[model samples]
Target: MTDAFSSSSETVLQRVLEVSLKSNTPVDKLEELYQIKATCDFILEHQFAKVALQFPDELLGDSVAIAEEINRNTNAKPFILGDTSYGSCCVDEVAAEHVGAECIVHYGSACLSTSKRLPLMYVFERRAVDVDRCASSFRELYPDSRSNVVILYDVSYAHAVKDLVTILSPEYPNLVSSELVVEGERCYSPGFIKRLNNDSLPPEQCDSQVIYQFGRQFSLKSGSSITDYSMFYIGEEGATLRNFMMTWNRCSFCSFSPATMTGRAESISVNRALMKRYYAIERAKDASVVGILVGTLGVADYLTIIQQLKETIRRAGKKSYMFAMGKLNVPKLANFLEIDIYVLIACPENSLLDSNDFYKPVVTPFEMEVACNKQREWSEEYITDFRRLLPGGQSHVPLADQQDESDETDVSLITGVLRSHNLLNGEPAETPSSSSMVLRNQTLTVANTNSAASFLAGRSWRGLEQKLGDTPVVKAVEGRRGIAIAYEEEGTAS
Candidate 1:
């Protein structure tokens, strides 16, 4: 008994795993690692049993490992779901082989093996159906009644499957419910789902519940939508942002990362640009928009609240735009939402605030501001090739350039105040290999003991109140002195 107990405790699951995650890491990370791996293994084992999905031709590079994993698990004589690379039920022989059955069938075929209904696996790859005869003849021989359909596809394809689950849930609740697993999470078919928009439904409900509980376990609250009414007021869990999620992008300037995320940038840009375009065109709102549904206000709980706002706006007859904010690591949201332009604000740009690191030093705050100003300038400078995305000639956006504002800091310290934070060439991968990469921020200047812009190369201090007895403030521009403020008691206004 003692030996068995000791051995079991030594396993990864048994480890006490007392982790103190930083604000940038998921607090429930250790537990998620524990759960995500186990779930993946279970699904892999079942898939290994039957259809034997294989690697498609488009897969490149070290997919050999994935191919080999498929080969090692699949048995010979497994069924083929399809031939096309991206077709629905588009699984290869090896990935399918990881399923519990020897035959991988399309949604129509999936219904016959067990009951009046069955696991209608939802996959992205499409293929021709063998509608000639029912599988009764084959089913009679195997005599198995279980229908375990697996819906395997990239998360990029989630929106496609989103509607399908609505119908699938109610149509075959028990049959479909028991059979599906997606991305290591229990995925319910749309038919089994009673309502497409409800937050309380199964699978999605379970997903949110788990994430919320786990996020809290790590001392993080997922970010939620910010509303004019909810400002400084208590909000539901979903509408609040996770401090850690914001920090995960871990920008020292704004809450989220900017230049690093292309999709996010594009999405935000496209939405805003498109809206200006729509307004310019004087597009009239029609009654057709009545059927449109705004995103639930509380969506900030599960998804990025900013993105949710864009979707809600789109539904309300505005142009499609992506929302900003969050520590999202995937481009799926940006792509799925059809965003074209993204504007980021996580650098030493605009107001005198500085973020030491958005991690990539090349993109500094001043640099980001420069980039944005350049884009706007270029738009006006060369509107020829540029399709006027926004309908109007120019947009009147709220900017930090309020006329009444002034900086009281010493003018010498604010060098490069209008510089851009992006690469001169604007290459996507902002860095060269280690051969050319340099820690540029190390050379940047910050306020020091005498309160001059001394150079420092590390994380920034919390808003200047702590380090200096006095903090800088915007002045009336009466004397024209800049970047320094006359020191005062703590009660002085910023």
Candidate 2:
């Protein structure tokens, strides 16, 4: 009944369609592929009672096609749990349309919220945007959960799920009635997983950190991996996916951005395009921000992003501080991103301290946490950060209006992961000392004081050199100094 990609909503989609048609196969082909895969998968695995289809809110057209394709390709028919009434004009239709059989059913209230008891299940677990909640709320399905509660994880949430699933499975033996459905070939390394879960935190984690100075922050653990560039591997047992986090449409023309020096828009057009159409995120502010870069091309890619951001921030003012994975190529990114401060997320590749890389001040995960904590409204802590003024309020947020709403005490699933290790990092650096990129006598600063990164490293970690080989601190980035972070391309600053 509803029209496909309309002018108001289909501008982006239409452009994508145009590109796909001339460059690749028709958009419909993707759905055909899904239909085939789904049909085969279902036939091979559908010995169970029902099937649950999970995807983001963007897939809503061609529900019938998907069903038909599945039935057409497979020996038998399978039920689909999708409702056209609950459409989210996205490419997910590529999967929806081809599922062309009547065996599919999302029979309730046209919407996911309204949908009723129709045998098939539709799962959409986007946070806050949909308070409807049932999309992926997994717990004991009760005396009647035999119907395989297939939990599907795309690249974004896949990595996070891998970690959380491991931590939680032991506790939810009865809860997991069905097998876990992790798609998107995003493999993560065992080292990263082990490192993230190494620290001690409660199940309902309360640790989120200041990404950099100037109020920028992100979760230590996002339920999603977000980036899916297959070139970016997380390691063994680590879910691997292609990194498609960069948005290119705007990058081509950005001159004021510093990243342009490191990564030409021409080279990163693919990164930008993938992010724009599929999964691009930008800052939400008009203020200057700080950003950090890391690893091989990671710094280069992020630098280009920061440069574009700076061009936009000048008029607005939200500039980002830059840092790197290790000390490797910090200056290349720092200058491009205009990072006022620096922090090292990891030295796995030696980006921070290497002579080949740019010079940067020291930063540690703990310092970054301090900066992030500063922005928190501290809505639900039994204790407040205001020093007994409120007695049980351990929160000190940067905003006035968000104070109460955030106090609801809703800790995200990833919050616990942040609490374990210091998600924040920072360390001071002298301006152009002797060999590094010589500049005036300015010292690098950490963006946030949210948590005490300096203090955290003191309490938890001691010898950075002893623990992590190749990536030494103090020389390039001092141990326990601190680290900074940046905003996404969309200006969706936090």
Candidate 3:
């Protein structure tokens, strides 16, 4: 018994040393990229019975190492998940559910879409940055400027933020850093914001505000307000930068790359992304068949959003089809030629698909709402995350229990808004005898083709004549020049 105890202790110590050596750089440098201590602390605190540890393909090598550390320190069982069904950035809830994981610890770059069944904890990838060099570069770029500068950064460079502020404090007295605010029951990830439009919350809490920064506010005053503060982002130009620009387009912003140690103005790129989004929104308005691409099922409240979309499309007198494939690629979606537009129900990061290369225009849920809802005027306030579609609930509730407002007769389908309308083209639209109108909404078929329905109902239509009731068949005469005059020859030949 004594020998066995000694062997086990030595083994544990060996594992600890191995991990320590692997991450043996300065504490600041080691923690900058991935917060090993914080991750373990979170796991221990949650006391989750089953935990799913997700890592991107590039970071998969560190999975065993991370799991071992967590297992050694806590009682939670860590299941290493790989090759997400959808975009690698989005949380793979399907993978987590396989192991019956209660929560997910996502590592690396994440789209930050809300989770469905499993709550998620994100460990953003951190890259080392030379704080002094960045501070020096800023001084050179804006030497004459005296306004307060707000430091915004990609999740990957979150660790370098503190060092940056410290290095630049002496030179720039008003340098401020922005931090994301998270308030929810689930474990909050770095980039994800809480659901904004949840109706269950009281009126005071129902207001949608995704990004909250704790830096100086922009202002036009002689003194610096948050509005007047110029943005100094520390990351490469990509989705995060694009989203940030769209969120604060009016403010002056600059993109700085810690990897390359270079900076560039992002006004042109920001405008271009906004312009493309606006164009896609306008094009979706004319679509007859809208495809609701179920890009993710694991996202919390996705089903609610899907049902809402179906009703919204129907009210707008447009046919909607649901497509569910883990990954939404252009090649796969192009197969559905009938769909004029596709609204991707994906994480906020991957939701705004660049349709420049796609055969059909793909828009986000926000754009879909704008296009399908006639009364919805275009607004600068844009929301792409699925959680923002509805309020967060305590637990997943049955669809039947949820209240649906579409049953109300006073609602107007043409305008896609709720309002009382007694007449349509000077005729009573409904007089308690409008069964057809009611049935139209209830029995709407997936396929709008008349021939397909007729063929299924034992009827002979032109193309399907061979399948059903007898219809005279014409024989082809390849060598005959007067075959066009078949009607004249029919009576004579009989």
Candidate 4:
């Protein structure tokens, strides 16, 4: 047993050390992959004085070399950013703003969420792909030449997509390839824009012909619905594939992995994910206290959605608290035992948190909306992006009025107990003037009205205690201390 434990410990230590080591790549290949010349041109054209270069953990091995090259070519001062405040996929605008950087150049895999504050650029770091192999795999999986299909790919493999389309388009005329929307470029598809402005068109005619999700956009052929198409993504398995699977659960989905150089059909249970989200919504509806966790500051209109969620919770007669903790973990969230449930307001890619390790259920803004707003109805069309819940978005669901049955009660599905609708009444629960005794588990205890405060009070270790007058005051004395690593008394004790 001891030998096995020691071996595992040594393996973990080696992996930790390996993370700090840098992997070397040739200079010319690095420059071509990162498009150093294009980045230098962008900096020069913008006349930026200070630029922050952000790289995800995997790509950080080459960050120093890339920064030095950019500094040599461009007049702008370049600095490499360390660990990001939130998800690495997001552009760490908050970190860039702290250094007063005029712009940011992000590298590696990105969520491509729109940044609100700073001007940003992305370098996908082009990856190699065998177009012929991918073409052959596509034909095998999709034997029918007239099958309705849409081709989407990871941004790293984007450069080879044009070649793949050229090779496959000749035989398969129904094949469509989606385009990635870059910064400072037109966002909405032509069909989407046309349908939006044409209010006089009938309901069926006004429905969008273009489908947009995350950073990619594609239009369907006239008279064909989105449900009629099958999605084929080219990328390694990760959050991007999961997001695509959940968002378009109705469509048939498959993926091609460039690393393995093989194509395989994905059998992700989209219904299972949606069922879990629905369960979270039901749990939130029964919660008396909701903690609104701010997961991002870079995504556009985050503040607006936070405010909207707060108001919605208020109208539902529930208590809410806002937190801005950098990144969420079990320990950070566990510290707040008072909160019954948590609502995470983050970018679409980072919003869906796996709550298996969390003490309480964590829900997204859309789920919170369905729980608090009586007007909204649950549907299979799940939305992870908080922006879509904002006013004027396609999935926007309005909050219920304050006067709508504020005092009604409903039975909780999980706890089979009647819960009051107006338990908090849009205010913090206050301690009653007189305490009542209750028998719980054969023990008699004084019951307090403020459940949150009572929970903290019951904890044995309730932080540091402040005894104002119980303890006698003592004179100040010099303490033996040096630095944190080594104390002054350590040498004398030795």
lDDT of each candidate versus the true structure = 0.24, 0.27, 0.62, 0.76
Pick by TM-score: 2 or 3, better one? 3
lDDT ranking, high to low: 4, 3, 2, 1
C-alpha RMSD by candidate, in order: 25.1, 24.6, 14.1, 8.8
Where does the lowest 10-residue lDDT sum fall in candidate 3? 1-10
Tens digit per residue, CA lDDT, model 2, 383-454 = 100111111323222222222322112222422211211111112233222232222212222222222223
- Those runs of model 3 whose alpha carbons end farther than 4 Å from true positions after fitting are 1-34, 169-174, 188-227, 267-269, 386-494
Clashing pairs in model 4, backbone N/Cα/C closer than 3 A: none
lDDT for each residue of candidate 3 in 1-494, tens digit (9 for 90 to 100) = 00011111222111222233243234345344556667667777777877878878887656666676677778677777766777777778777776577888888876555454666687888666777778877887668546577788776776677777777777776666655433346756533233332344345433422224221122222433445568888888777766666666667887678889887766575566777887887667656568889987666678888988886666655667888887667789766666778999876667877877789999987787776654455665566655655545221112221133242233333345433211121121221321223223332322122221222344233333455456667798666344665744354454
Model 3 TM-score, all chains together: 0.66
As for lDDT, the candidate ahead, 2 or 3, is 3
What does the lDDT come to for candidate 1?
Answer: 0.24
User: Residues 34-99, candidate 4, lDDT per residue (tens digit)?
Assistant: 888888888888788888888877887787678768888986777667578889888888777766
Q: Pick the candidate with the highest TM-score.
A: 4
| lDDT tens readout by residue for model 1, 1-494 | 00011111222122243333232324344222112233224345555344322222332222223223333444222322223222221222222323333433232111111111212232222222221111222122223334221121122222333343344344333212111222212222332212122244455333321211101111111232111001010111111122212212211111111112111111123234323333321211211111111111111121232333233333222232223322222342322222222322221111111112222111111122222222222131112101111223233212233243222211212232322222121222223222223222222423111101111222265224564647666577545333346433333466
State the local distance difference test value for candidate 2.
0.27
Cα shift from native, residue 494, model 1 (Å): 84
- Worst ten-residue run, lDDT, model 4? 1-10
Candidate 3 overall Cα lDDT vs. reference? 0.62
Name model 2 segments beyond 4 Å from true.
Answer: 1-33, 36-236, 239-289, 292-334, 337-369, 372-494
Give the lowest summed-lDDT range of ten residues in model 1.
227-236
